[model samples]
Structures are given as structure tokens and as C-alpha cells.
Target chain A: QKEVEQDPGPLSVPEGAIVSLNCTYSNSAFQYFMWYRQYSRKGPELLMYTYSSGNKEDGRFTAQVDKSSKYISLFIRDSQPSDSATYLCAMSAVTGGSYIPTFGRGTSLIVHP
Target chain B: DAGITQSPRHKVTETGTPVTLRCHQTENHRYMYWYRQDPGHGLRLIHYSYGVKDTDKGEVSDGYSVSRSKTEDFLLTLESATSSQTSVYFCAISELLAGGFHEQFFGPGTRLTVL
Candidate 1:
């Protein structure tokens, strides 16, 4: 099994709909969890970041992490068409004196207008 | 785009040719990383540097090499590029925050196609 698992979803949703994207991992040592958004032909940009387990809210975006279940999620409330992009989940631990994140294959989201 | 820039944003080269991609950062972050993105596979780390002249191999370091002679520049070289090496490459810089947490910012990415 891969260290991280995320559905490669072309998840289509109507405008103003709420969107939920999730990823699961097996590493219990992963203390830092992050979400990144990438547009077509562009590099991934940091969207949300959370440490350990808890929820962090930023405007319309919320990031949740569950260390016990090894699950993480990103919730987009009242999504807009401009929110269409690939969402990637990454987690890292301080290994070998460095923190290198392991990424899951991104989920493609399309908020149609 | 946190003061990070990657050169040769697009390139096409024949197999067995040598190629070099450069990542330049102005943020002066102590951590720099190289990653490749491809279909079915997410971003895979190729290499990373913690300080000048300090570099280490990543998961997919085979068939690739890197050099960091200066703090602002980190270069990845494919001594003999292959079709399998063709992919979008990204350079990232990390800013260490309080409590030992770090955030990474990526550059615009370089697309390389080998035929």
C-alpha cells in the first residue's frame, strides 16, 4: 500500500455547493498535514496547513486532521467556479533531521457555474 | 511563488542528452527541494538541500544528480536523460516557523519532454 491514498477524483459540483476532499495515510508519525491547490499547467500552491490533529479554518476553506484514524480532509464551503483545481494532500514528520513531505495523488475538483 | 523561479519553463530534448534545470530562490530559505509531478504519481521528491553544498538523495534520486554551490541556486542535472525522465519539475523553498514547523512554497515548474 502507498504511504498516502487519495482518490483521483474529477469531482464535479455545481456552484455554491460544498465540497469535501479526503486523504488517508498509514504513518502515525506524520505530524504535519497540508493541502495544496494546483491549476492546470502550474505548480502546486499551499492552500491549508494543520499540525497534528484538529481543525483550522481560513475563510471558505477548512482543514481537518485525525491522527487516530490517520485521515485528513479539506472542506470547501460555498464553493465557486474559481475553486476548480487539483487538491493535493501532504504529510511529513521530522525524519533524519529533516521534514520531507509525502504527497498523495491529487483530487481534481471542478465547480461548474 | 515565494521568491522562487525555475528556468527553462519548457523544454524538449532527445533521449540520452544531458539536461540541467535550475532553481533560484531570493527568500534565502535554508531548505530547498526538487520534485517531479506526473500522472498517476503525485509529487515525488528528487533531492533536497539544507545548506550550501549540503544535499541528500530522495526517493527517486537514481538517474539524477544535484548540486548546490551557492545558497540561492540549486541545480538538478540528468547526465543522460531518458524518456522516463520527462515530467514537470518543481522547486520549493521552506520557511521555518516557530515550534519547528515549516511551510513550503513552490516555483512555477519546468516542463520537460524527451523524445
Candidate 2:
């Protein structure tokens, strides 16, 4: 099994709908969780990040992490068409004196107008 | 937009040819990384540097090599490019914060196609 697993979803939703994207991992040592948004032909951009298990709210986006279950999620409130992009989950732990992040396959989201 | 720029945003080369992708950052971050993105494989790390001339191989570093002679520049070289090496490549930099937490910023990707 991959270290990090995420559903490669072409999840389609209408405007103003709430969207939830999730990822699961097997590493218990992961302490840093991050969510990135990537558009077509562009590099991934850091959207939200959390230190450990908890919820962080940033305007229209919320990030949640559960250390016990090794699960992480990103919730988008009142999504808009401009929110269409691929969401990637990344996690890292301070191992061997450095942190090397592991990434999920990514979930594609499309907010229709 | 972390003051990062990747050159040759797009390129097409024949198999067995040598190819290099450059990642330049002005943020002066201590950590730099190289990654490749494919359709199903979101992004895979190729290599990373912690300081000038300090580097290490990543999961998919078999057919590739990286160099960091300066803090602002990191280069990924494909000795003999293969069709399998054709993919979009991204460079990222992270600065260590007070609490040891870091946030990485990426540059515009470089798309390479090998035929």
C-alpha cells in the first residue's frame, strides 16, 4: 500500500455547494499536514496547512487532521467555479534529522457554474 | 509566487538525449526540492537540498541527478532521457520557521516531452 492514499476523484459539484476532500495515511509519525491546489499546466500551490491533529479555518477553506486515524481532510464552503482544481495532500515528519514529505495521488474537484 | 522561476517552461527532446531543468529561487530559503507530476501520480520527489552543495536522492532518483552549487539554483539532469522521464517537473523551497515548521512554495512547472 502507498504511504499516503487519496481518492482520485473527478468530483463534480454545483456552485455554492460544500466540497469535502480526504486523504488517509499509514504513518503515525506524520506531524505536518498540508493541502495544495494545482491548476492545469501549473505548479501546486500551498492552500492550507496544519501542525498536527486539529482544525484550521481560513476564510472559505478548512483543514482537519486526525492523528489517531491518520486521516486528513479539506472542506470548502460555498464553493465557486473558480475553485476547480486538483487538491493534493502532503505530510511530513522530522525523520533522520530532516523532513521528507510524502504526497497523495490527489483529488480533482470541479465546481460547476 | 515565491520568487521562483523555472526555465524552458516547455520542451521536446528525443530519447537518449541529455536534458536539464533548472529551478531558481530568490526567497533564499534553505531547503529546495525537485518533484515530477503525472496524471495519476500527483507529485513525486526526485531530490532535495538542505544547503549549498548538500543534496540527497529521493524515491525516484534512479535515472536522474540533481545539483545545488548555489543557494538560489537547483538543477535536475536526465543523463539519457527516456520516454518515461517525460513529465511536468516542479521545484519547491521551504524556509524553516521559528517553531521548526516550514511551508513550501513552488515555481511554475517545466513540461518536458520525450519522443
Candidate 3:
């Protein structure tokens, strides 16, 4: 099994709808969790970051991590058409003296007007 | 886009040819990474550099090598490209922050097509 698993969803939703994207990981040593948003033909940019098992909110985005279940979630409120992109979840532990992240297959999100 | 630039934004090469991608950063961050993105595989690290002249292999580093001769430049070279090496390549820079957190900033990707 892959270390991280995420649905490659072309999840279509209307503007102003609430969107929930999730990922499940099998590694228990992951202490840092991050969500990245990638636009078409562009590199991904960091959207949200959280440490361990907790929730962190930024604007319309909220990141939640549940270490016990090895699950992580990113919630988007008041989604907009401009928010259409691929969301990728990444986690990392301090291994070999470096924190190299392992990424999940991204979920594509489309918020239409 | 954080003071990072990748050269040859797009390229087409034949299999068995050697291809080199350049990543230049002005941020002077202590760490640099090379990754490739393919369909169904989000992003896989190929190599990373921790300091000048210091480099290490990543998860998928079999056919790849890297060099970091200066603080601001990291280069990834494919000894001999293959059809499987066709993918979008990205370079990211980061500095080790307090609490062992490293928030990476990526450059515009380089699209390489191996025919």
C-alpha cells in the first residue's frame, strides 16, 4: 500500500459551497501535515500547515489532522470558481535528520459559478 | 515563485539523451529540492541539497544525480533520459525554521518530454 492515499477526485461543486478534502496515511511517525494547492500548468503553493493532531484556520481554509486515525482534512468555506485547482496533502517526519515530505495523489477540485 | 526560477521552462528530448534542469534561487534558503510530478503520482522527491556541495538522494533517485556547487544554484541531471522520465519537474527552496518546520516555496515547473 502507498504510504499516503487520497482520492483523485474531479470533485465538482457550485460556488459558495463548502468543500471537504481528505487524505489517509499509514505512517504513524508523521508529525507535520501540509496542504498544497496547484493550479493548471503551475507549481503547487502551500495553502495550509498544521503540526500533529489539531486544527488550524486561515481565512476560508481550515486544516485538521487526526493522528490516531492517520487522517488529515482540509475544509474550504465559501468556495469560489477561482478556487478550482488540485489539492495535495503531504506529511513528513524527521527522518535521517531531514524532514522530507511524502505526497499523496492529489484530488482535483472544481468550483463552478 | 519566491525568488526561484527554473531554466528551459519547456523541452523535448529523445530517449537515451542526457538532460539537465537548472534551479536558481535568490532566497538563499539553506535547503533545495528536486521533484517530479506525473499523472496519478502527485510529487516525488528526486534529490535534495542541504548546503553548498552537499547533496543526497531521495525516494526516486535511481537515474538521477544532483549538484549544488553554490548556495543559490542546484542542478538535476538525468544520466540518460527514458520514456519514464517524461514529467513535469519542479524545484523548491526552504530554510529550516524553529520547531523543525520547513515550508518549501516552489518555482515554476519545467515540462520535459522524452520521446
Best by TM-score: 1
Q: After superposition, how far is residue A27 of candidate 3 from its true place, in Å?
A: 1.1
Candidate number with greatest DockQ: 3
User: Which portions of model 1 show Cα errors greater than 4 Å?
Assistant: none
Question: Highest lDDT among the candidates is held by which one?
Answer: 1
Span of 10 residues, lowest total lDDT, candidate 2 chain B: B95-104
Q: Alpha-carbon error at A17 in model 3, in Å?
A: 1.1
State every prediction's TM-score relative to the real structure: 0.97, 0.97, 0.96
Order the numbered candidates by DockQ, best leading: 3, 2, 1
* lDDT (tens digit, per residue) of candidate 1 on A13-104: 99999999999999898999999999999889989899889999999999999998999999999999999999999999966587689999
- lDDT of each candidate versus the true structure: 0.94, 0.92, 0.93
Q: Which regions in candidate 2 have their CA more than 4 angstroms from the true location? A: none
lDDT pick, better of 1 and 3 = 1
List fnat, each candidate.
0.77, 0.87, 0.90
Tens-place lDDT per residue, model 3, A1-113, is: 99999999999999999999999999998989999999999999999789889999999999999998999999999999999999999998866576588999999999999
State residue B47's C-alpha deviation in candidate 1, in Å. Answer: 0.7
Q: Report the C-alpha lDDT of model 2 over B1-115, residue by residue, as the tens digit.
A: 8899998899999999999999999878888999998988889999999999999998899899999999999999999999999999999998676877778888999999999
lDDT measured at residue B43 in model 1 versus the true structure, 0 to 100: 95
Error of 2 at A66 (Å): 1.5
B1-115 in candidate 1: lDDT tens per residue?
A: 7899999999999999999999999978889999999998989999999999999999999999999999999999999999999999999998888977788999999999999
